[model samples]
Target chain A: MIPIDYYIIVSILLFSIGSAIVFTRRNILYVLMGIELIFNAANINLVAFGQLDPYLNGQLFSMLIITVAAAESVVALAIVIVLFKKLNTIDLNEITQLKEK
Target chain B: MKLIEIVFFFFAIQLLSSALVILFTRNVVYAAIALMSTLLGVAALFVVAGSDLLAVVQLVVYVGGVLILLLFGVLYTYRDPESYFEKKHVLLSIVTVVCIAGALLFLLSDLPFNYPQLETSPHDATGITKRTGYLWITNNLLVFEVVAVFLLVVLVGAGWIASHVLDKSKKDV
Candidate 1:
């Protein structure tokens, strides 16, 4: 049988990688992808623990999370497209025209 | 030794490799493709871990819906891929890596090594589908309906925003 710790370890690794990508990447879309990665990591953990419980609510919640993620991607990608058209660049650094340094 | 063990090992490798490729790739399109692979591997892992519903949902929502939208976003906003290299922040990247490593170390320290003793037989465990279906329709039906409605709204909103941006850009040119 596969151990639960292995799942936990994979989750942590994916989460940390996602965090790293979010912090370090300049592309706003990549940052959003990183956020998705983090969400997936959380979903993995939830499903892993859900396997332990008898009611399977964790599995249900994970499905809900997947739907929410799809919605989030749509909205976020739309915003990114609009921003790219207005500025002609999607780099996070270049989009700081509104910021008062 | 068993088929399950071999399947788990292969899927884990695929998940880790694809995830790393997604992170390290310089091309946005390639990274997106790698992300797809990672998502598929995760879905497989979900199946192995006994959440068949989640596995199907993961495939449909993430791979089918989210990834297509992401690919559309990338294609719509095409810039020179190599032009993105000018704004690298070395110090912040180092700090972020160090902080993540520290957190991972702390989490590793607290994990219990002993596996929990679960008593459900394989045949009975496979009956999760019937149980989950009853729970969904009986008590959680409303939440499911709400999510479907939310997805519809999001689709309309995204289409509107993208088309509006395209029209304005055409007028500008």
Candidate 2:
């Protein structure tokens, strides 16, 4: 069996990449993709930790996370669609109408 | 080298590099494809880690359902096939990535984790699946039903907002 440390390292790497994409990307859709990556990294951690326990509770939580993530993407993409229709662009920087001028 | 190590390395490399491609790719379509590859790699990792049911869920939900929705969302929003990346804040992203990595390494190294050696104990994959189903019905039933309700709400809410936008667009036309 491979050491769980390696899996943790991979999770951290992917999480950092996801965070970087979220912070730097102006495209709203790509930011959502980055969010998905972060969700995945967390899932990896959950599954890895579940391997340590006999009850497999972590795997159960990871399943819940996956379900929530699917629901989140549906609602978020719908909002993105509405934003694009209203603003005519998916650029986050350009869609600052809610910000105080 | 053991076969398990090789398989682990293969999935890890595929997962990381595909994710990097997703970050760097300027084209939305290509990025979506890369995201699919990354999801597939993660599914493989789930299996390698001995969670076959989660692996299947990862494949079905992330790869099949969400990725398709994302691709449709991408294509629906943009008429200009080429969706360029936001490289204006690359310096900020680099700094953030470094800080996050440092923090993660610091935090990860200090954690005391005890991994029990289950080498002699052979666990059946099918048994795990059966136990998971039993858990869902017995202990985790509430959470399961809540998620179902959440999905229903999301479905209705998404359709509502989408049609609201369409109605306004039609009115303007």
Candidate 3:
């Protein structure tokens, strides 16, 4: 039988990769994918805990997280599209016109 | 090894490989597809963990909705794949991964590892579905309604923004 630690380790690795992508990627879409990855990592933890809890609240919370993630992606992609059209590029490094002086 | 172990091993391999592809790929579209595979593999993991509801929602919301929108956004916005490949920051990414992994290891290392004994009863598929629906309506009804309304608003807003941008671009051209 595979121990639960194995799952936890895999989730940790994924979460770390996602965080790296979020912090280092210049592309807006890649950053959004990173956010999705982070959300998935949280969901994995929720479900793992749900397996132990008798009431299944963790699973319920994961459902809510899924819904919220969907809405967030929709709004974020819309913003990305608008930014792409305006700047002709989606690289975060190039869109620094809003940087504090 | 048992069938469940074999299935889990295969799923874990697929999940990790797809995650690596998503992180390493230069093409945005390919990364999106890799992400879709990764999401599906995670959903399968949820199933293995005995959270069938989470698995279904993960499949429907992440794989079906979020990933599709991401793919469409990439197709509509980016024209050249090579353009995205420029400005590689592999060293920074590796550093970030190492630091975050080290921190997470420190934080989670002391977590208890006692496997709780699951009280097994007859698996009533219908019971889970029925209870989930009841709980959604009774306990989380407000949240459910808010999410539905939020999704509708997002749909309208995105449509409006997309068309407005298209029209403005056309005028400028």
In model 1, residue pairs whose N, Cα or C atoms come closer than 3 Å (at least 3 residues apart or on different chains), thus clashing, are: none
Model 3 lDDT tens row, A1-101? 34567677778888988988888777889999999989888888777766665556777788888888988888888878777777777888788774222
Tens digits of per-residue lDDT for model 3 on B65-160?
Answer: 898899998888875766655455677777887798788888889776676644431222432456667778888889789888987998898878
- Candidate with the greatest DockQ versus the true structure: 2
RMSD of 1: 3.2
Evaluate model 2: give its lDDT. Answer: 0.85
**How many pairs of residues collide in model 2?**
0
Task: Give stretches of model 3 more than 4 Å off.
Answer: A98-101, B86-88, B113-127, B165-173
- Span of 10 residues, lowest total lDDT, candidate 2 chain B: B118-127
What is the DockQ score of candidate 1, to 2 decimals?
0.60
Better structure of 2 and 3 per DockQ? 2
Give the TM-score of candidate 2 (chain A): 0.93
Q: Which scores higher on TM-score, 2 or 3?
A: 2
Q: What fraction of the true Cα-Cα contacts (under 8 Å, chains A to B) does candidate 2 also have?
A: 0.71
Give the range of the ten consecutive residues with the poorest summed lDDT in model 1 chain B.
Answer: B117-126
In terms of TM-score, the best-performing candidate is 2
TM-score for all predictions?
A: 0.86, 0.92, 0.87
